[model samples]
Target chain A: MATLELRRLRKRYAGGAEVLHDIELNIDHGEMIVVVGPSGCGKSTLLRMVAGLETISSGEIVINGECVNAQEPAERDIAMVFQNYALYPHMSVFDNLAYSLKNRRTPKDEISRRVNETAQLLDIAALLDRKPRQLSGGQRQRVAMGRAVIRQPQVFLFDEPLSNLDASLRVQMRQDIRALQKRLDITSLYVTHDQTEAMTMADRLVVMNAGRIEQIGTPMTLFRKPATRFVAGFIGSPAMNFLSGNAGDLPGWLPRVPEETTEPLTGDISIGIRPEHIALTTPNAGQIDGHIELVEPLGSESLVHVRPTGHESRLVVRHVGTEQPDAGQRTGLNLQGPFHLFDHHGQRLATRPRLADTTCSMEP
Target chain B: MRYHRPGLDVAAHTLLIIGALAFMLPVILAVLASTQSPGTLFSGTLPLSFGTSGLDHYMTLLTEPVRGVGVPAWRLMLNSLLMALGIAVGKLTIAMLAAYALVFFRFPFRRCCFWLIFMTLMLPIEVRIVPTYGVVAELGLLDSYPGLVLPLLASATATFLFRQFFLTLPPELMEAARIDGAGPWRFFIDILLPLSRTNIAALFVIMFIYGWNQYLWPLVTITSADHATLVTSLKRLTIATDGTPPWHLATAMTVLALLPPVVVIILMQRWFIKGLVDTEK
Candidate 1:
């Protein structure tokens, strides 16, 4: 319903430490962007700034092509659902939903109608008379959502709205939120530290680290083509493994690198291969050989941890019940699929360049 | 359910019974003495038996006007009630708003303002009675209900108690309301006020008693009998009478003065405990 643009957004505290650097992002109408990051990554601060709950230290926030940097939260025509389900504890579910409309001077009958519709949509009609404390966690979460949706604002902001729910409820609410968002076709910006939620629910994922955007793209695109060493290791469950080596040696261990990158051979390279991309083969059958250190069976697929010869860090392999290597057994790892390679500065180096690229060589 | 200890139970029950009797003895003796004439009190032994003149003495105390005391009993009771209610309601309003501002707003020198209010806790009306009386007199609030109520309005304990409650409130609620288009006044009336009802009730009980028991301030502030509280009027009934202590109507007035606070405590025993301990929401 609305497009949101953050132009060179930055947040600096009074103590002179910048918590969020110039974060530039643009969202199309009806797009759901999930900002995923670690705890101190400033994702929540960014969301709050968009919600107008936090003051912007610099830059502009434009919603629906109208600059709202100086506007109040209510004046921004946005509604937010909080992680703790911040439904008013003293108000009934119906009153909670009706609060914003009543404040806007909506007709009483119209307010009641909208509340009823939202309650029915959220499947919380039976809970309208109950106080927040009387309801269960998931029920309260629905009421929180209902409160926001009843306003029918142009944009919705969710700050880890499912973080407090149980794991099963979290999964259920995740799908419910996505379905609701699509059904209403409302623009949303959801923030969470859970990568799975980001991958499953986001139309685009904005991966952040240490106050900066590491990468922003679709989940699969970011998964397959990460832009930095941080994004490569962050977006996956059993995070991508990085092996440090020279570019000339990448074709031997990680065949994902292209040929003819004859940069100075002394430059260090961080080669990343996802755990699932590596295959288990007999010793002497592949380019790299290692001894299995542990086997973790995860029902569908088992993660095999191996200590590659001459390397101190252990590399993991995902196997689908085939060629399961045991403890202290010698195995060969075939990393013939696509992988990520970064330089010492953590910026991703080019792969599949038609000719020798100057970017990798410019790292020095 | 936690344990089964017969000896401890017996010891505890026995000690509690003796303690209860020890506390109730003075009130019981006062009730019995109010039914008797002043001569029986001079007989040296405490009266254990009820007297025949109970209704007569109470009726006279309620209906008849006493010498040297300018106000009647019922009017004095009315004034006391008004003063206590006014003080309780007034203090709660001021303290709750002060606490709400202190907890929710970020202003310059907010901590300084809070500590200044907190410093008033050390100086009760009894300690600063003269100065407070001087201010009240200068303002011409003397001999008025506002005079009785205004000087003792500010309550640091109630303010801090409400401040603690407001601090425990999650900040997300405020943000959600803000996002819901609730201005500050709407949020306070619709959200904060209802949330603070229990704390207000508890503080009301405590403050009402505090205002009801104001003896020194009322003595210093109110020279007119029309404005005297029941607590101050109770002193007028103590005739001394060659140190025999009249003992009859004096006991009746004492009983009357003690009833309101005791009734309040018993009526709100549950909320009183919750308010005092603050162990629940």
Candidate 2:
């Protein structure tokens, strides 16, 4: 019955710049929700608000069955891991982990037990007595995680915890965090600007844009059916390629809607298709054609950038192989994936396009 | 170091040695003169050789301490020690908490408050000594240690230094402590104080010396022998109402007054250097 709910949460500065607007979320017990967006998206602000580090302008935050809006962070029974790994430079790793427990007046023996268990869990037992300055970046990150875990708090707040590490270390720590969060089954709210981290680590991803929730769902659901054009463009890697065509079907689009149809997509409607969804076909063989501009072969899969024959916009196709066409080649792009169409207002089109007749199973 | 000229290096070394000896000559002269007869002072010719009566002079000042112009030597030294330690600790306490408030907490007109405190630095005890003395007398603290220490604490130099240091501390540490269930004071004592060790040590040395060298305020305010400080007493020991002052006894008192400050600096030198260097780093 454990639950964390954010109802009508809003944040505005004294200058009346609203940074978070109507953020409504229900995070059940043991759920790991990663709030992700571009810079200045207020994702970190939302997390800090829930952690009681920032005040909510007008809202109620319910943890379990109690409203903790006015409670101090310590009384709220939550823990936070910061981006800089804010380890106390003076204390050893052991003391860092034992800090909260010690502050709570936990018995000395219990403090040692909890610190030892957390260090062992994070595989940092050997570095227990070393100062934070003595450890490497990855080790410090682990200690930060251990500090949060030692308290056994009801919720965990992470503010871009892996953003400071090297590339390889970032990847490793992402897995470590996900595994640890699952093992503890702690209700956690993680924030990051990296789409990959959001997708890989989140049980449910909250997509924010310009101070509002664009969409919230599992990573697979958001990837397959992004509710808004921004979500579609932001969810996938290399971002979903967007093309605005004239009233008619643009290049790389299936010619499903008849020219004299009763209702048609009008008024600057845009199409969103993932780069991996577009496939390469022979010249003039596919539903639409384009001229290949650049082909970036990344060993296993290649990204082929093409300027559609009819529209001035360029689209990318994630071709899955070492073999790919070169630049300046005339090719047909198969418009076969789940097509996302946005209206002139950038809202997702309510109905999926009935263009499956011309689609092929090009799932390479 | 990269472009060292042999001749210039030799010339520079010779100049620095001469400068070092030049600075030491006055101290050496005072010591030699203090060893001679008590009456040998301010004469056209100065004594260069040491006399055998140096111990007798210091003993006279420390034990016999000429009748009634000042307090006993041991009592004056104790008073000075208490005053120095009190001021050093008091300034640090007030400065650290004030800097904490100025840096970590947001209030109305915090900048205005900091600037107002900073304005006091220009008005040392010298400029406002009369007003300060009246205030002390009004409060019935003319001969109290608090009177001596409180006025000095109003200076903002240490507060400014600490504010700069506290500003450099990552804000996340505060947030982290807050999340860890540490209240403001707990955070200060547990984490902030530990991190500020070197800075505190350095401030202790400087404040001790400043407190030890305070002669004007003590001389003006402390009219009793009970609260007479070492520096003021040394000055009083130099004057004679009816005859030439005793040079040997005055110099011996000066030499005794220098010991505590030098000892403090020597003890805290390591932390002083490390704290100053590592803070910005």
lDDT of each: 0.85, 0.85
What TM-score would candidate 2 get against the native? Answer: 0.93
What lDDT is reached at residue B56 by model 1?
63
| DockQ of candidate 2 against the true complex | 0.65
Model 2 C-alpha lDDT versus the unseen true structure: 0.85
Error of 1 at A31 (Å): 0.4
Tell me the interface RMSD of model 2, in angstroms: 2.0
Q: Identify the runs in model 2 with alpha carbons over 4 angstroms from their true place.
A: A246-254, A257-264, A287-291, A328-330, A353-357, A360-364, B1-19, B39-44, B47-49, B273-281
- Which pairs of residues have clashing backbones in candidate 2? none
Candidate 1 lDDT, tens digit per residue, A227-321? 99999999998999888876555434545365423333346778788898787888867667899999998877889999888778898888887
**DockQ for every prediction shown:** 0.70, 0.65
